[model samples]
Target: MKLFYSPFHTFVHKVLVTAHECGHWERLTRVATFPFKNNQGEDCGDTYDISAINPLDKVPTLVTDTGQPVFGSQAICEYLDATSRARRMYPAPGPKRWDALSRLSLCDTIFESTVQMVMEQWKPQDQWNMGLFTWLWPKFNAGLDSLERGAERGWDDFDVGHASMLHAISYLGFRAEFYEAKDPVYPHYNWREGRPALAAWFDTAIQRPSVASHYNQPFTSDSSAEACQAAVRECIALRAAHGQ
Candidate 1:
């Protein structure tokens, strides 16, 4: 399989966590995409060559050995669950499944809101929109509060939902400086305060091998991308050495 992603893309990292948790981290070729800007520093093409497969031209796009394309974190992560024989995160239809899916929705909602805010920040000050903060900012905080309240259930097993939450929370701290910038509309609250259960849960869960491997490095162009390339290279070498 071949996957196109940007290390700073929180959504893309969800797929990475899914792959790692499924014990197939070394099975795919990880390709880095310049989603923001190319070497020229010009505005990026919304649909780089990846657009050929995904019209959105988004990262976290995957192409399986059979040449089937899977785009978006949900499709990619669920695809991994369907194809792999390892423990499945998508529990068989039950209350647990519904609960997990609900959490996934809340977490991804927060992720999307943050993506919008960050993208808006990329624009000049004059073009800023007040509605984003008026509407989206509160919701993002509410979602985090929801997760913190459910800390016990949120980080229980590191399933697909857990992967979603992990990616979301990690990015908040990872991009702390950006989020903390002088944007009155943007939120700069302490996420760990008054949430000992969730804080403790994340403190431990973030150390898992899947997370520590990809996210431990600075999430910059050279650092994170280089780390991902190295992981893929190592995975390939291991597979080759084992004659698989």
Candidate 2:
């Protein structure tokens, strides 16, 4: 199997981590792609033809040995668990599978919301929509709070559901800190700090070679102070233009 991915993307990291846990990481060939560029002219790392593999032009697109294409991290992981000799990451088709799917959906929601928040802040002032952030952030926090409560109730095991959740939490900690810092009132903003089990899970997840590779590469730093300052200026300019 050939795994086409951008090393700088958290979504790609999620897929790689799952493959590692499933013991299929070494069996796969890593195809690098240029998903992000730094200040220099050189591509950061991981070059691929996203459009060729998947029309979505997204990272973490997996190509099976039979030439089947599996896009999306969740779908790729599901495919791996289904076809591999490794222990099923997801349970058999039954109540357990349904539960795992639901949790995975929750994790996807959190990831999507985080991406939305980042785009809203970083996009040009004319393209910005403060209303979207105002509306979505509260719901995002509510979802995070629910996940926190679930973890508190002892759902932090390595089941398919919590594996996705662990990936989400670790991704947020690494990539979405700017958004979280901007909105500290988020319900589960500090959830990981006190949740030792979840924290440990995240710790282990981030240490995998796949995850470490992503962090070790150079990419545009959206969470940097300069980026935050630029976002703030853009927001203020937008507000002023609207006579707010």
Candidate 3:
């Protein structure tokens, strides 16, 4: 399969982490796509016109060997788990599978909310809406608190769900300052301050070769998805040079 990959995109990072967990990271052919200014004067990243493969023109699109195109991050992660030589990320049909799926959904939802809220910050002052601030941010915090509680249960064993949460936490840290979030809600958004268990787990999660090697872009206010695409391309070159 070929993966339209990005290094700083939380969703793409999520699927990459899942692929590594399934022990099949090397199977994918990575394609780099940077965001560009569109006629609408908005930031758009579908330089590949991914819409030809995925009507949504989104990143992390996977074109399977059978010539089937799969878009969206969760769908790609599930696909990776399903086709992997080892059935490690997703459990077989059963209650355990249901539980894992639910956890995966929660992590993805949190990650999605953060992305939405952060994107909203990109609009001009006149276009910004306080209603989103009142609604979306609270939802994001609820997800964080939910994960905090889940962390109490421990997150050492790497699974798709664990990868999900780790990406959410790390992505928030990576992009927090880029938004206009203020105290109490974001307030530097030091997610580790009150969440001990999650913090401890993150300490380990970030060290994983899969996490560390695939994602190492220091937080930058590039304000364009192109930076993410560049980071992924750079990582690919580095990995190839090292024979990884």
CA shift at 158, candidate 3, in angstroms? 1.9
- Candidate 3: stretches off by over 4 Å: 9-12, 35-46, 180-185, 217-244
Q: Distance (Å) between predicted and true CA of 43, model 1?
A: 9.6
Model 3 per-residue lDDT tens digits across residues 1-244: 6677454543228787777777777776666643223333444434334455667667778766655677898899888988887657876688667766777888787777777766666777567666766776677777777777877976545778777777777777867656635422455667777788778877877777677646764433443446545544454455456555
lDDT of 2 by residue, 1-244 (tens): 7666655554335576677667786787665554343222445332233464568756667766656668888899888877766666787788777877888888877776777667666766567676776787677557666765665565534556666676666666655445555542352456465466556555665565645655445554343334423433443455456555
**Deviation (Å) of 98 in candidate 1:** 0.6
How would you order the candidates by lDDT, starting with the best?
A: 1, 3, 2
Those runs of model 1 whose alpha carbons end farther than 4 Å from true positions after fitting are: 9-12, 38-48, 152-156, 218-244
Per-model TM-score versus the true fold: 0.81, 0.69, 0.78
Model 3 lDDT at residue 217: 45
* Worst-scoring 10-residue span by lDDT in model 1: 38-47
Angstrom error of the Cα, residue 220, model 2: value is: 18
